[model samples]
Target: MKKTIITISREFGSGGREIGKKLAEQLNVPFYDKELIEIAAKESGLDKELFEEEDSRTSKGFRLLGALGYSLGGPLSTITELSLNDRLFLVQSQVIEQVAKEGACVIVGRCADYVLKDYDTVLNVFIHGNMKEKKERAIHSYEVDERDIENSIHKIDKRRANYYEYYTDRKWGRAENYDISLNSSTFGIDGCVEIIKEVAVNKSL
Candidate 1:
């Protein structure tokens, strides 16, 4: 059987991360969330904080090479030419591809969906929820400060959208970009996981 990779793009406070972890446990595969940042930092010898900062904010310039998964392919002296955000993105994307190549796994965020776009055995999923449901999850589950919680959610989602669009040239959360889009509000976290789990398992057949 061939290995399968699952990449999840989620709205903030939608419990999408939790669903991804649960699905990985059910399938007995590796799960990557913020772990990707740590791995990239360690592998690239860059500070972990750099990856954290670049993970959300949109890049200002120096996009083309990184978006295309270019690695400079030249002397180490060439690395200095790229912007900080572009450098970090290229490193993190390399980490994403390496892990996917290792085996079946679930990777959350950091544009793993776009980075692994060419993989034949990959399943891309986007998870979203209504404002009411997402707000509740944000406050109660994620503990996103109750004060101005709605604004906080909006900011996070927008950052993710901008970052994704800037690199992928595709609209984030659009149905056409993913193999499956799930409404966590309607199906609930476990339900969504079960749905993805079934599809992933079937793909390995």
Candidate 2:
């Protein structure tokens, strides 16, 4: 069987990360989330904190070379300096490509759906759940601050959507952008995993 690459974009506090993990485990593929940040930091020799900051915020998301998944061929001499956000984006593109090349993998967030657009046999999925369901997941599964969970959810989702749109030139959460969309609240995590598995199987056929 051929390898498959799955990129999952999700709303904040929606248990998307967890769903990706479970799906990868079920599919017996590697799962990548925050691991991309460390890879970028290591490859660029930048501070991990810097990458983390860039990873979450959308302010500097629109940088040159972000449009086409920064070319990995040239030496570092061409670009004199890179902002943390740009460096992270470039490095992520490299890492995402490398991992997908090795074999099947499930990648969560970081606008991976856009970065891996050129790769064949890639499944771009969006995972979202109802606000109430997400709020509970945020507090329980993610251990988010309970005091102001509502605003936190909205704020984080906005950042993700903005970063995605800024980098990819595509609207986030739009049905047309992805191959499959799932509401985790409807069938829960495992069910979503099965749904994706079926779709992936069909795609392979």
Candidate 3:
């Protein structure tokens, strides 16, 4: 198969991560969700907890040029020099670029669409579901408290939106920014995966 990169942005309870994993398996490529954190940690020599803490959170400091550069591998790369948020962002951005450069892979979240914006074979996707369905999915799949599910969903999605916009200068969940925006509510997770697979394959060919 032709090399292609798929990036999935999702609402907290949307099951978009599952679709990305299945799509990657169908396409015979590595899937990067949690694995991305490991890669960044290994390459950057940062604590894994740093990645989890800054996961999808906006950078606390402004250094657009620094974030764009990836060759910060030396003694100066210490956490004391760079903010943890900026360091993780740069390292993960580098890791994302490295993976896409290698070949086809499905990356879920982490502003991946914006990270690979210049790549020719990348397919950017956004997945979402209605509040009612998402809340139910959280309750059934994640066993989130029924009483707290709605607030939890809103809080998570707001963070995602803020992170995306802060880094990419693009609105989260906006259809125009992505190659395709899918509603898991309209099409089930399997259905969404099939459609994404079809689109990714066709584009690769």
The lDDT of each candidate is 0.79, 0.77, 0.77
Worst 10 residues of 2 by lDDT: 55-64
Task: For candidate 3, give the lDDT of residue 149.
Answer: 79
Tell me the lDDT of model 3 at 160: 88
Leading candidate by lDDT: 1
Stretches of candidate 2 off by over 4 Å are: 1-3, 40-81, 203-205
- Tens-digit per-residue lDDT, 129-195, candidate 3: 9998899889988888888779989998999898777666678988999988899999999999988
Arrange candidates by TM-score, highest first: which order? 1, 3, 2
Candidate 2, residues 1-205, lDDT tens digits: the string is 2328899999987778988999889988889896754564476543443454442334233343645644433543354455666666766766676777878899998878888887778988999999899999999987889989999999989999878876666889999989889999998988998888888877554
lDDT of 1 by residue, 1-205 (tens): 3437999999998889999999889888988986755575576654453444442334322343545654444533355455566656766776787888888999999888888989988999999999999999898887889899899999999999988876666789899999889999999999999888887767555
**Candidate 3 error regions (>4 Å):** 1-3, 43-82, 203-205
- lDDT (Cα, 0-100) at 17 in candidate 2: 90
Please give the distance, in angstroms, between residue 54's alpha carbon in candidate 2 and its true position after superposition. 20
User: What value does the lDDT take at residue 185 in candidate 3?
Assistant: 93
